[model samples]
Target: MNNFLAHTFTKKAFEQLASIRNQYSVSIYLPMYKKGKELNEGLGQSNLKSCLKKVHAVLVEYGYDKSSVNDYLKPIRNLIFELSFWRNPSEGLAIFLDKDKGMRCYKLPFPFEIKTYVADHFYLFPLLPLFHNNGIYYLLELSRDYVKLYKGSRNNFRDIPIKKIIPKQLEEVVGFDFEQKMLQYRTGHMMYPAGSFHGQGEGKEDEKKELLSFFRKINRGVTKMISDKKAPLILACTDELYPVYKKINSYHKLWDTNLSGDPEFKGTNELHKASWSLIQYYFETKKREKLAKFISKFHTSLTTCQLSEIIPAAVKGKIDTLFVQQKEDVFGTYNSAKGCLILDSYKEMRNISLLNMAAINTFLQGGNVYFLEAEEMPVKNIPMNALLRF
Candidate 1:
């Protein structure tokens, strides 16, 4: 089953969409203002938990319970929930989420940044570190869908045809069959069994030598993109191969941890952990500077301030990003203009609940939450703040 299948909830057919449509409004937020607290009573307003409750009411099967909200929502904060309503269209959802955070959620006139530089199907195989690398036929199907949806109709998000929309460019786009295309596949933790073959047992030095050679076979199999250092390579391997992969994380001047290892995927999650995979070559190195370059490339940022000092200065439009956590119980808006924000990331992290709200403020104003896979962000990893485009 596809990894996303667990998330796809099936509702009643035919009349289901109608009932849920009105139930799930496009915009909802748990105010940052604390419940029963005036805007002046505390630092922020209605919190994200309230907003997540509203989303839960709209999309999932559950009622909002204040006591349980925090525990339920804790996991979703640092992760990206890529949802495509089997019944609903993608544009409409993107529009809603984009609007919820008050983002510059504009639809592209065209994937103008991309030139349709079609690489041979085989060539697209190794770049599987970001997002799901599904069926080869499905990708071509996605291309066909893009041609149909994005090619015309003035490229409107809502009115454009979903049937025609094809996946467009982010920094980069590559294709591969997760099962058949890679030279090796290993576990994220163990790093063994590069595809159909397993390593041979040997004496201590020989075993180390063989393992090193194995990694070479895996890493040396770089595509033109990596060999020439055009864009970083996202490798595909199982969890077993991870230790081995990391042991040789520093190769002979060649490092490609852009390798994604999703054990859930049987391959490709570690290297692509978090939504970093979505970023094509963004977080691929151990070097402090190489990673800083990518994290600093974020398209959004949270605007923060001390309640006593900054609230007076934050005019409605002046603040670009506003963050709020899903279960946080905030009460009111700063003045009369802004709306509440919600963070529905379900995960664990260091003081992430606090960070989640800070992140929400960023989104409430139309910025995006820095979706992290793990709670503790590394010093070398992209700083949530650094990614802001502004």
Candidate 2:
């Protein structure tokens, strides 16, 4: 079985792409459908054909022999028949090919709009969403009969195999003996009912203490499993249980906002949608704080919105953080040797996006990029903005 959960867009993958110095590098981004006829085999083949047609045009324009180009793309063509690969679809797929690099493919956790970029170096900005999406978060659903754990991102959610480490039910951990013990406590120590279907010999306070003890045990196991992964954990349970869980939670990165109500009735899609809405605000607020600092230090020779100056600085590893409009594109070329930018009319360089180059270069140099709405940007007139390291 494939452990897709281990897949990550690592720094080594970025270095490999940045080092490719090929004459005809092809970058293809395809939106993948999870199911139906679109996912079976036909859609992947059709998309590859469409992308190849575009690549063929670029090769012809650059004066490459048709046979040589075909040979370079042959491995990619054969990948279309890998039924097992096609069956396990994520949100998107990216394919990079060249004469020297051969062909490499990545199944992304987030979807990309279908597009093709044929360039001298591999076009990499389309893969940024995998990094910028803040990766994954854990969701713990609590209840008497249905305690479940899930591994989730903004676009996908799946159950985590945690039954072995953490017990999934009250009976599994405390056993049926607690029921008779609770009745004894209630008859001897309490003057009123404990307010739920399940009861024993204890008062409400004692019962609550027992439940807290159970939750703390679960939390310790969960923390041990996810401590190395620093992703946020969100708790989903009833309103009454939320406070109890929060009080006992030892995980440092547990999200303040939680999924309230019983999660047993909720579908994966519904839970993911709600969780994403809350998590997005956390990401945006973090970006805003960084952007605000950039604005404050603009006069210290460490911040800029000038495309001409920022492009070369990004190439030299000076950028610390960047904020750019999500879908905006600018047509131009950069001369890395002399740190010069050559802007062209839209009719001249239709395929090259200078904005994408800036973002890609920044990421390659270990800088951060935030895709903000127009209103959220520090400057609305310029397409790019950055905070410099030096």
Candidate 3:
């Protein structure tokens, strides 16, 4: 079971799946429920069974003999009744199969539209959010008494243990003898405990200095914990603490915007919601900036919205960025020898998805790929667009 199924989906896995080209590649996507009656009642397993049925039908329609089709789908069929496999499901399940690669399944974090595709290549546009820039980040819940670290993506968040590497509380680093009065309040509105002396201007400055020292230690620990230094780190703290932390933060990718408010009062889900909102804006801004660049170069040789031009450019590693319309498929075959693209209204035996090919090539060659709504495309009504490297 562990050999066939994967819980974590990475860009490397996506690239491997995309690189496969076969005569009877099978891609299946099923929306899964993590909780509720649907989970307990085996609805996910049932849904998978239905999807497998579709896959079997599609294989038959392609003229594979009954025995060959059954043998090809046997791996998936074994999973239909595997109760344990369905019990711990993610928001979606993606399965890819071919004669050469056997079968690989991923329980992905994002919900997917239920569909299946049997073609020369796997359908992968549904997994783009995980690969998008700003899609993954770290959220540091910073406070004097409590500290936590979370690794977050566009739709998932999980705690990353920092207790061993970092001090869990400011007292651990600054010692218990530091001014108790200063520690009582983080914001201007925070009330001093009854009978505690409320200090004047100098005390506030001292508090800042103490916090700066504590944050410096935290910054060191956080830097050590983060394997990807370029990934953004969002600070979750009150407005007052943000400036003090900023003064001490050594991380280059700390987000300019802090997750404002007292993080102590927020649950993990609340923190995820707030942080994802900020990251989404960051992602949108980047996409818009790219779109603006595309528009500026619209009439030049550096940019193009034509599928014929984009497909070959991608194959040759000439695209800097490729924009594809969401929920749309352009099936075709590309002749590398002739530098030609032939579009088909329907999927055929020899044709693959041109948009998928362009995206995969661009991504594999270190270019960016963005899936946008029809209205958000650089050129309206164009299904695909590209910014060329040369």
Candidate 4:
């Protein structure tokens, strides 16, 4: 039996979802319990059944006959009985399907509010957290005898094999000569020592020089492996080795803080937890800065809480940062040719979530999209806000 559930969701996947342009695309999101009684009792299966019912009703409203609707949703219907899928679930589930494309299901690491959206495009705002500055990072665990690399996100972390491109140890770069050189070095008094060699300062300098050569080799392979040079790289190593590696580190986004320990003993989960704690401050500060910029420019042409103005600007690629209230939907139809937006009081056959439109447009244009609670929104009572690029 094929599990049919995907555990990893990437930016590429999000882009694929955005690029889909089917008239009857269905997107369903549901929070799932990772363990305990809820999962044991098959609550996720029942929740999915409820969402399927809603989707069927919407498809019927779109003028699909009962037989066609059943055929269209057959893939999703099968999931309700896929026992293995419910047994190993993530914090949330997102399902996207259409008559032509069939279905794609992802077991996401974060929870979502129960939502069923059928529109011309997928409802993607719930997945914004995965792309925030807090989104993806690389961890390079360095030591004299060990080297490992990992790709990490908020709730997922796994080792990335580097043996093919990177040396597994200093000896791989320096050869057996490293053992002979090690005899000359001695630990210094500092808690995180940068060692000394036989009472001579030159010994410490030679050690630094050797480590610099080793790290430069590692940096070359790391740079080659990481295609996204802008993605932050966190170094997990002793305090002493940080400065040595920094001298030759060519990666522009290498984080300023080091994990500050013998990384060889720590598991991926522990490293992910510690690295996230260090880098989260960076994302928070960035969010604060954007909010402050919006507040400073509020009431001017540079900022807006108006959905009508925001929608057109988004289409034209004018948005710089967008803040949207979570669990809120603004249903409307937009005609790009006429630059018209019609807001409906309720969900209609032709209308889609205007907020989704704005968010996806802004994202595709290299703008930031942030989902905030009502209280966290920059302006009170507004469901959407934007900081314009202009």
Candidate 5:
């Protein structure tokens, strides 16, 4: 009741809408928030009857027919009918069709509100623990990319993500904020805790299932949207979970790497040292060509923390990728963070400047980190290892 279902259309529709935008020689100026927009009666030709009919056909074809759509679409439908009256395209009437859906019309002039699903194609998922503090008092590490992050004040929700990116690759590349359909990771959603190492407590099947199902559904839906549309996949999890998460998705869980519950790793101090060595190995062997090829090259793999640390080393700047049961903070140059680089640091590394390389930075760098799975964080678990090639 709080939010509407049709609101979901905002995300997909905006993406589809853009495909047809250039046809009108018009540029869309989306808002960062709900600033009250001006509703243009028609975004198509006056003689839009033919267009409406075609759109209707598409709606019927797509699954929105009778089963999915509602009984009332008065305003939206009439807006389509009004299109047929326009004569020229200059009146800004054309390029109005986006995927030909059952709901052809919408609450027009949707001011560019950045929160939730208000932006043309922007969506936000709140913060999740990815890594934790390394000291006695454990605190989670938080990181985000392609998002508008606004830090809340005292007593306010800290690390709350207000916007999530679900736009087309083209829009994302050009820096377009399209807040459309918004989703959240709810409680009992299958997550491995902030820094969980055990899968389900001794008697937590029901609890685990509830959480797992949620994560699975989201993962399935999200991966598809991201893969097909080449959209950005924003993840917020625990630092310990990241390595295990990566291993499950890709990477060989080699016993030789000594990630098992070994007796030697009975404490945090030992585990952090081991994990640090593993990371050091990767950084030491990193290659410039492999990373440089994608530096600002415009590609999809750029979003995941999978390639998180590579670029940080490339710039030879300070980068804190996260180590041990608790999250550790590292300070370094901010240049690459502007784009084609890594995370931001508190202490500017002696060899680097935290200067903005541009204005945008990559989402995977570890300084501002989070967890993905718990096993990767063992008392002596060195779960993740960065890969480097000659």
Candidate 6:
């Protein structure tokens, strides 16, 4: 498996998910087993077909041309029979399609709710979890002789085999004299100094400059791979090299905290354990800050927890921030064209989720969304709410 699960969550990926056009669109999400399991057991494929079937039924009821409906679903039908696509799986898979024949697929490191949407625009809320709390991040372990890249989240991580931007050791890149020159450069201040070449010996400064030059080359190589990424890059290196690497790093999302040891000596699980705490803390801080903003605007018309009020505003693209209870699905249907919301009990809507639709609309319009616990919301215990832009 040559980087079978190799993927990066980048700003461009999110933009594609958020893009909207006035035409028939399809979004499908399903959990997938990654390893040591049977493939294409029919569960995921059947779910996708069922979602398309519902879309066809709706199109027929509304008097769409039979050929147009079939044309709209052709990409989906093609996907169902693609057995090769199922063999190389991850934790989940998400597929998007449109009437223009554009399609995109993502093999996720985490599982997503098994849901589907067929509408005027693709439903994006299901994919938001990848960017929201506890989502994906990167860990880059750097040293003079070795470098390793990993992509994962708080709970799990996987190595991204380094093929580009390979870092070489001092001896390998320069010569054995590199370390001797480095030591003399640092301790040249000794009273009984061994003859300084330039009296004040700018050799140490030259050694430092050389190392910085090497680091700069490495940074350029790493940038090509992760420059478009939004996830934080947590760096790992020796204590002395940290300052040097930081000065040369151009990746703006590099985390403030980092591992202070030789990361190459650490295992994947060890690295994940050390890295997750910082990632969790960063997300929690962001959530707290957003909650404070919401509370400050609670009495204003800008914030609301009313479902009836939020549904229309969401459809109209007025939501600036939304806080919804995690893993709690609300059943209903939303007609974006009419701004109509018909709520039914969870048991009644079958696979349709109105809460997800509202969130999806909000995200498509470039709104920030937080999937928070009930207590973390401005209005505690409320299942759904939003901080409106208007």
Of the candidates shown, which would achieve the greatest lDDT relative to the real structure?
4
TM-score list, all predictions: 0.24, 0.80, 0.85, 0.83, 0.18, 0.64
Better of 1 and 6 by lDDT: 6
lDDT of each: 0.27, 0.75, 0.82, 0.85, 0.28, 0.70
Model 5, residue 223: C-alpha shift (Å): 1.6
lDDT of 2 at 14: 69
lDDT of 5 by residue, 127-245 (tens): 11211221111111211122111121111112323234322121232233311211122243435443344664532353334334333433333343332232112222334434443
Model 2's alpha-carbon lDDT is 0.75
Task: Please provide, for model 3 over 1-390, each residue's C-alpha lDDT reduced to its tens digit, 9 standing for 90 to 100.
Answer: 323787778888887887787878898888889899988888878888888898888888887788889988888888887778787888899898888878889898877878788986788867776777546789999887789989987767999989768887777877777646544563444454311334666655556666677788899999999987767999998776787788878899999999998899999989998899888887677778888999999899999988878888998999998988888788888899988778889876667778777887888898889988898888888888899989
Displacement of residue 389 (Cα, Å) in model 5 is 27
**Candidate 2: deviation at residue 89, Å?**
4.4
Candidate 3: list runs displaced more than 4 Å.
1-3, 35-43, 176-198, 201-212
Q: Sort the predicted structures by lDDT, highest score first.
A: 4, 3, 2, 6, 5, 1
Cα miss at 219, model 5 (Å)? Answer: 0.8
Top TM-score model: 3
In candidate 6, list every pair of residues with a backbone clash: none
Q: Residues 256-300, candidate 4, lDDT per residue (tens digit)? A: 989999998987778989998887776677788999999999889
lDDT comparison, 2 vs 5, better candidate: 2
Alpha carbon deviation, residue 253, candidate 5 (Å): 18
Error of 5 at 68 (Å): 60
Q: Regarding lDDT, does 3 or 5 come out ahead?
A: 3
Candidate 2 per-residue C-alpha lDDT over 1-390 given as tens digits, one digit per residue, 9 for 90 to 100:
111222356657867887887777778888777888787647976887888887777776777787677777777777766677777777788888877657878887777778777767777876676576566788888865567788877655778788678877666667787777566756855655332424454356556766777788788878877744678898888776777778889899988877888899998888888887777776556676788898899777898898887888888889999888876777787778777688875512134668777888888778888887788888786778889998
